[model samples]
Structures are given as structure tokens and as C-alpha cells.
Target: MTPRIHGGTDALGPARWDFSSNANACGPCPLALQAVQQADATRYPDPSYTRLRAALADLHGVEAARVLPAASASEAIQRLTAWRARAGDRRVWTPPHAYGDYAHAASAWGLERVAGPALAQLVWLCDPGSPLGQGESGAAVQAALEGDARTGVLDCAYAPLRLRGASALDPAQRDCVWQLWSPNKALGLTGVRAAYAIAPRGSEAAVAALQALAPSWPIGAHGQALLLAWAQPAVQDWVAASRTTLAAWAQDLRALLARHGWACAPSDTAFGCARPPRPLDATALRARGVKLRDATSFGLQGWWRLSAQQPPALAALDEALQEQEREAVR
Candidate 1:
């Protein structure tokens, strides 16, 4: 079994200067947060999620029947993988560097990892992809959608957080593939585990299969509240404004790392991968309450994926690095 490698809070709890997660630094959106807090936890959410589905569909301008709720993006990956596997899918293709769950779920469901999209039954695509914070190539996107029988899942987790570059798949093309969305990261409320997918226009049978596999009331009250708030105009405005702040901070992060001789790669989003002048002492940084995501798990060994943080957190990172340098000299 492949171990799941992730960012954000862990066994030791969250780091004070946590650049490990790509969540919106300017969030949690006040409206969204208020909604989540006010959720009616005492009672169960509507089992059918009729209103939630309608609201999300309205936001994306899709039919309610095409909206499939998920417990989280990871859960959706597993469920989708299982759906493909049960349908006799034997081969899967994922981005060279992507969220670990894509491969992890594939492995769990006995799907073989293929080298290319042309040879796979299920294909995973992420725009402003994780770790690298890069978009998929046009060729890859076209290939993933080529086969009528193939299952293509486009992870839109980072779409809302994208500071630059448009998605590889346009609106029309998106309707041909499953578009998975997890708004928690965009709202700066990563603690909420709720996501949904816009099923391909003609995937009624596939959506039914995925839904049947899901447990009743997959999304709890708090998650329902988050999703409802996500569709609001005010919440969308907050997310849009956050991008400006994140873009400036991203520049500060790049300059800070560059000054220390670290080579930073350009990313379309607020986070990017960078290789330090020397090997990083992750434990030392942790002790200083500074945490960064190791890119090794994402296949970029020797590099770290750091998200743009506020000024104070960035300063904490700088001080921690300088302290490490001083200790190395001693």
C-alpha cells in the first residue's frame, strides 16, 4: 500500500509558519466561516442533499442531476477509482507529479499505472497541479478526453487559488470530463471535508454508480454549510481578492528563497517548488515552528513545495533558515 503524503496539520499539530499547505492565506472567508460555525450539527443534513446540489449546480450553471457530492477530494478519488475498477478498468494514468491520492486510490483498487493516457482506462488531470503548481499540457488534456469509454477526472482543487494562467480545459471541454471541486482550501477552511464533482454531461449511469457506492449523507452539516457559503457572490469576491494578496506574497517568498541561493521554479499558483542551496533540515525547521512540504513524495526530490504566506510567517521562515545556517557554522 502506498503511504499518503500530505501537507497541513499532522500528528504534531499545525506549524505556526505553515507553508506546507496551499490553502488561501487570506482566509477563512468571514461569511463562509460564519456559516460553518452556525451549522445545525444537532440534526443530520438532508440525505438527498437536494438543496445543496441545486445551489452548486446553479453556481456552475449545470443541471442538478450532474452534481455528485463527495466527502472530500481524496474520498472522491477513491470512489471514482473504485467505480472504474469495478467497471473492468485495468489501467490508469496520472500526472507525472500529482496529488498522491490519485495513484494511491488506483493502487488500492488494483489498477495498473500506465505511462501514457492513450494506454489507460482511467485518467487523472489536475490544473495548477499540486506540488509543482503547474497546469497540464494541452496534449495530455486532449488525450484524456479522446476516448468515449475512458473515465477522465479533472481535479479542480487549485483552480480557485490560481494566481496566473487559465485552465488547460475550457468550459465546453470541462463538461466532457468529471470536474472534482473541493472548496475548503479556497475558503481557507481546510478542516472542512466536503467536495463535489460535476459529472460529464452523459454520465448518468456513472454518477448513479458512484452515488450508490457512497454512504448515506456523505457530507455532514458543517460541510453542507461550507458548500452553501461557497456558492455565494460575497464568498466568491473574497476568494478573488485573496489572489492579489497571495500573488504579492508569492513574489516575496521567491525573493526570500533566491537570496539564500535556492533555485525557485515558476508556478501558475501561489505555491512553487524550490531547491535550497543545501539540504534542508526539516526537523530543525519544525522545531522553529516553520514547516514546508517535502517534494520528494511528489517525485521532485531535493525540492520543497512552499506556499506564499503572510509577512510574519515569511519572516519566521527567514529567521529559522538563518538560525540553521549559524548552527551549521558552529
Candidate 2:
């Protein structure tokens, strides 16, 4: 089996100044944090996750039966892929640059990648896509809606944390596809694994298929608490406020990188891809307590994905780049 590539704190343990993962830089949200800290681990969560699912449904203004909970977005992706594979769907379509787990899960289920949304049996779309934070084209979304694909999933992991711009999909278009939400990234609780999907309006059959493939009690006590907290007004308020901070930080970080001669791609969200004026020795920088995501996995060679972080983290990165430049000159 091929290994999966991802960002965030990796096998090397956490970096002092992590620019790898695109999780909210201003979090973990205090309210959500309290909920996680207060979670009761003494017993298992409800097998059906009735209340939890209902709360998530209410948040998205969907019917309770339309919500499908998973251990994480990756788990949701895998289960959905498995469901499509079992139904004899063999082709998958993905955006040019997207989260790796889409392709990884598709490959695991023997689904081949096909060009164009209209040609595939299963299609994946990420609005404010990963590694770039750019929204998908509205025309392409309309095309996917009109395609013959059996299932289409829109990963909304970054949607909550989107710093700017509007979604390409309108309300009706969004209802035509699976909308996956992993609030952990927005809440800065990525360590807590839990995610849920809102099935397309009237997608009972698809919901049933996904539930059948999922293990019982997909979310644990902590995950339940985190998600429950996520539905609270106070938590939503916090997330909204954090975006203001992230926007400022993102602008500052971009300017800093530009001053250092890095070329950055324009982004609508808090994270983006950039290329250093010169090649960077990533491993050496990691050793210096800073880590950046190599965008190679996202198919952007010679570029790196950077999450907008606070001044301290940005300062560390600036110093590390300077050190690398000195070493290169030597």
C-alpha cells in the first residue's frame, strides 16, 4: 500500500512554529476547548449519535436524517469511496490541487482518476481548496451538478476558516452534493478526530449507504463534546472573530514573505502557496523548529503551502530563511 501524505504535526513530533497544517491559527476556540476538556470519557458515546447528529443538522439547516457522522474527514472520504466502490463505481474525479486523502482513498478503493467531472462515477470538490485556498470555479461546480456521477463530495474543512471571498457553489448547488465539515480545523482542535457530512437534500439512499459502511459509534465522547460545542453560538462567534485576526496575520505574513523575495500565489483564505527566491532545504528548517508544508503532494512542485500564523511564528520562519540563505552563500 502506498503511504498517505498530510500536513500538521507529523512523525517528527510538533514543530515550535508550525506552518504546515492549515488549522486555525487563532485557536483552539476557548468554548470548544472547555467542552473537550469537560468531556466525559467514562462511558461510550451514544451508538446512534442522535443528539449530536441533530445539532449538526440544525447548524446546516438540514434534516436530521441527512447528517452522516465520521471519525474524521479522511474517514468520511474512505467510507464514501468504499460505498461507491461496492456499487461498482470505478472512476473518480478531483480538482487539479486538493487534499491528498481524496485520491488516497479513491486509490485504496480501486477507483481510477479520470479527467473532467462529467466522466467520473465519483467526484470530489473542495471549495477554498487546500494548499492554495482558492475557491473552485462556479462553472465547474455547475458542471458537476449536471454530471452523471453517482456521488459527489464537497470537502468543507476549510470553509469555516475561509478568510475572504465567497463560495463558488450557491445554496441550491451545495445541496446537490455531499458537504463534509470537519470543525476541528476551524476550532483548532485538529487532534480531536470527528467530522460529519450533510447529504444532498433528499439523499436518503446515499446517507443510508454511508451509514451502513461506517462503524458503530463513529464519534467518541470528546469528539461529541467538541462538535456539540461547535454548534453553540458562542463558539461560532469565536470562529468569526478569529478570522479577523487571521486576515491581518495573513496579510502581514504575505508581506514578510514577499520582502524576503518569495513569490506567493493569491488566495482567498488564510493559507496559500509560495515559492522561495531560492530553493529551500526543508529538513534543515525543520531541525531549527520550523516546518512548512511541501506542496509537491498537492502537485505544485517548487512551491510550499504556508498557514497564516502569529508574529512569533512568522519571526521564527523569517530567521530560519535568513540562516538558510547565509548557508547557501557560504
Candidate 3:
């Protein structure tokens, strides 16, 4: 039998195509690259983050007082958890198959944690929830907060595909008012650790009080300057171009997989989860150079999450799937 030519499927070795994380496969903003390169390495990055905070504040539709920058989005969310889980309330809530760091951050606070639907104090949603890549509507998000309102954290870490409303989670439903946004997801600055979390308007004291618990500077002067440059209109176009290319390719790749025996779905963002038509596990397929993330990690076991952001990935995926089909039939 001929090898299937699924788009972006890694039929290579471990991390064959890095379908696990959602970092951009396209490229980083040249302006960001230049900024990092031109950074004064000897000088200490201003932890004050005056410029960074201001930039993020404008995007968030809040005062610079309402915004604070931490080392990573993890730092932001974790510190927020530490603040809320103070006293006797030591618990953080997350959806089943959420990011491990969310739980890790909560645990650092010595707080109790739970996953899957709940009315708990701390609730974490991917905005567009993950493994499925579907975003929850803003109203529904508000409802979740109002249901309890203790400390809500919107993990829009994946929302760059379509972006979110500036004030989508305003007024703090559970009196919860923290939103996590990682610039690395859309900007491909993964190693830079460029990430942030926004608190409500009156959360200034909470932010200041929680500062000691927060992590130090993440991206440094290099990352800081780069992020600002990326915020420009020209760089924004680069992001848009990448999105359009990936979106069209994703649709085509999904269609290609369906045409064969593989069952899959097109992702709303760059990631999509689907099962192979054959009786093969994601791990077993790895031996064939098709290492994909086991959906089990995302609470979607028996399936795999594949990234189709590059030109060569689709052909690789198709080839891998075809091979799998032949082996299964035999």
C-alpha cells in the first residue's frame, strides 16, 4: 500500500514535528529579533517593567495600575493563586486536561486543587479550551465567575488565533479577576518565556502584596524590547499571514485525513485532536517517525493532537497515516 501524505504529521522520531506545544512554527517578528539582539546585556533589565506594563495595559483596556508583569504567565497565575488561597482557602480549580503548570502553581501555594466542572474558588479555562481548541464564549466565561467569584483565571494562552475581547472577563464574576496570556504562543518566543496575567482594576494591592511571591524577570531586556516591536502593525501582519496560511492548510489536512481512513477534526486554532482510523496508539506510531502528543495528556486519550503549521508537515502526516492504515489492515 502507498504511504498516506497527511499534512504536518510527524512520521519521524520523538518530537518528530513537535505537535505537543502550540508555539508558532512560522517565525518570530524580525523587529523582536532585532530588539533582543540590540539589548544592552550588561545592564539589569528594569524589573519595574514600566514600559511592559504600559503596553499590556493599553491592550487590556485597563490602567497600568491594573496590570503587572511577572517572569512568566506561570508567575502571574501562581502569584495570583497564592494571594487568593491565603488564610484557610487553599484550593485552585482547573478543567480536566488543563496545563500542568496551572496545577503546579496552585500546589506551590500549598493549596488544594480539583479539575473538571466545579464551583470552586479558583477556576482555569483555556478561553478556547484545549485538546479540542474550541473557545468558550465571553458570556459563559462571566457566568463561571459569577457562579463562585473567588479567584477566576482565564488561561487564554491559546486565544491568539482569533484573539479575545479587551474586557471579555470584566467585573470579576467569582470576584475572580486574573487572565493568563502567553506571548510565546502566538509570537514563537518560547524560550523567551514571554508571558503575563492581567488582574482586575482594584487588584493593585493584590498585585503589590503578591509581588514577593512572583518570579523574577522572564525575557529580560531582550524579550521586553522584542515584544514591544512585535506589537507594531507590520509585525502584526506577519502574524496574520501565518494564521491565514495555517488555517487554510489545517482545513486541507483535515480533509485529506478524512478522505483516507483516518478520522480527525480541523482545529479552531493551530492545534487539533483526532484519532487514527487504525487500531494504533500514538506511542506505537512514534516508532514510525510519527510522534504525536497522546491525547490522554489532555484528557482525550485514544486520540492525538497534531500541529500543521509548516509546509512539509502535511506531507509527513499523510505518509505516516497511510503507513498506519496498511499495517492495521494486515
Candidate 4:
């Protein structure tokens, strides 16, 4: 969970950006490159995300009708969660430190925002948390869903790194909704603008009921093809490489922070969490030119979420942390 700064004007391009949850800090998937070249500019794409939906359906072992593709996981989760909220479910509870988008979506529906175990109609959680990059069990997730008409949204935004994902929702729970993987993180297609949802099959009416509520078809032709390629077995192998690189970087970040006496939360994946109110830490670090997210804005208890998006960031972290400590004396 990173603080959402209003205008990242000063932090714009020119410098390589590292604070991201996407797979390749570099760019879109190679598979996506092929899709972009192959797109037929002469005609409109399948308005339904049909080919792409079928591909994603096969990946999840579900029928195509049960899936819905969107602009991003942010939009996909918003639509699904908002639909449930509209259907008489009032509250949407999420963890304290969240991706910022979930809370934004919940707020859109006029749902009362309460986070973490307070008993709400809907609970949105990133199983492998965004800040800590740690995942929770499907069984524990299911038990939480049992308490309310709440449809638990397991945001599998970083499932690839943890090797775990959204299998918590079954065919039964009338209140379960799953926010599947955000391709930006798992497949390196951040600009491809693709994400899909896995709803229980046979919920055609429920699905259609949702469809009718939407104003228009999501995902253009080019975006659809990009998602389909990313879902391929061959391309997922390349995604595996990115995960390996991220894991190594995560370890390095933890070590670098420890040298500065920063107690980062033990993480299972790339993003490491830590406290002692890092807002000032980030401000101080930036003064000497090392940019990172300050966790203060997340409303969590004084923690920061650092991204392991680049190898060069390893050296950057060391210099920044050291500078932060020195500035403290002044």
C-alpha cells in the first residue's frame, strides 16, 4: 500500500519509475507485441472480448460465459464489486493497507467503508497483500465469506509470484465474487489494458444481470488479443522469468533496509512492508533523489511499500536509506 500522491508532476518520466506492481518494469509482454502488429486496424474487434474470454476461460477451467474482461483489474473489480453492492449489500470491508483502487471502487457505490474483520456485507482482500506480498489461505478466506452476504474479492494481483491464487470462491456461496489476476503484474502487459473475472458458471442470469447494468462493451480488439496471448502456456513461461528476478530483488531490498536499521515486515514476495512512519523517510530520501512510496497514505499503521521493479534499484535503495539516516541528525 503506497501513498497516493495527487500530482506526481516532479516524479514524472526521464527517471526510470520503480514503484509499480507490474511484471516487467520495462514494458509490455513480447506476446503482446505480436498481438499489436497482428491486429486488423480495418475492422472493429469482437465487442464481447469473445476470443479473449474463451482463452481466459480455458486457463481457469471454466466456461467463457462466466468470465468478463475489462480495461484493468481496477475496472473489473469495480464493476463486479459495485454490482454486488448495488444488489442490497451495503458495506465493503477490506484490509487496512490496500491498493487504493478497491477502496475507491467501494466508495463509488456509496458503501460504508470499514476495513478488516469488522463484519461487513462484502470483504475485499488481496490474498498476497500488496504491501507485504504475503498470501492467505483459501480456507480462511472462505470462512470469512461465510459471515455475511458478502462476496469476498480476492485480488490475485500478484498471485504469480506467490504461486497461489483465487480458488476460494466455489459454485455455492451466493455471496462470493473473485477479482482475478491483474495482468499488469502477472503478464507484463500494463498498457495492454486487460483483466478478467471468474464468476461461477451457471450464473448466466447473474452475469447477464451484471452485463445489462454496464453502459458499453469493455476491451477493444487490440486489448483482447493481448490478453489472449498472455494467457498462453508459452508466454506464461516468460512471466516465470520475471517472477524469479523479482524474488531476488525482494531479498536485496530487505537486506538493504536492514542496514539502515529499518524493520521491514518479513515478506514472501517482492514488496516489503515496514513501519516507523516512512512518509518523512520517503520525503527525505527523495531530497537526495531516491523515490519510493510512503505508506502513511494507506491508513495502515506507519508502513511503507517498496517495489522491486528494477535491478538498479538495489544500489538506489542503499544510497537512499543511508542518506535518510544521515539527514535524521540534521
Best by TM-score: 1
Q: Could you tell me how far off, in angstroms, the CA of residue 252 lies in candidate 4 after the best superposition?
A: 1.3
Q: Give me the candidate number with maximum lDDT.
A: 1
- What's the lDDT for candidate 2? 0.90
For candidate 4, list the clashing residue pairs, or say none: 121-150
lDDT digits (tens) for residues 186-222 of candidate 4: 6555556667777654566777876776656576666
lDDT score for residue 77 of model 3: 68
Ranking by TM-score: 1, 2, 4, 3
TM-score result, candidate 3? 0.82
- Better model by TM-score: candidate 2 vs candidate 4: 2
Q: Which stretches of model 4 miss by more than 4 angstroms?
A: 1-11, 14-17, 20-23, 26-28, 115-118, 137-140, 163-176, 276-284, 287-289
lDDT of 1: 0.94
**Residue range with the least summed lDDT across 10 consecutive positions in model 4:** 1-10
Candidate 2 lDDT, 189-290, residue by residue in tens: 899999999999988887888888888899999999999999998999999999999999999999989988999999988899999998889999999999
Q: Which runs in model 3 stand beyond 4 Å of their true positions? A: 1-16, 108-110, 114-118, 137-140, 147-149, 163-176, 215-219, 281-289
| Candidate 2 deviant stretches above 4 angstroms | 147-149
TM-score of each: 0.99, 0.98, 0.82, 0.83
Give the lDDT of residue 196 in candidate 3: 67
Clashes of each: 0, 0, 25, 1
Please tell me which model should have the higher TM-score, number 1 or number 4: 1
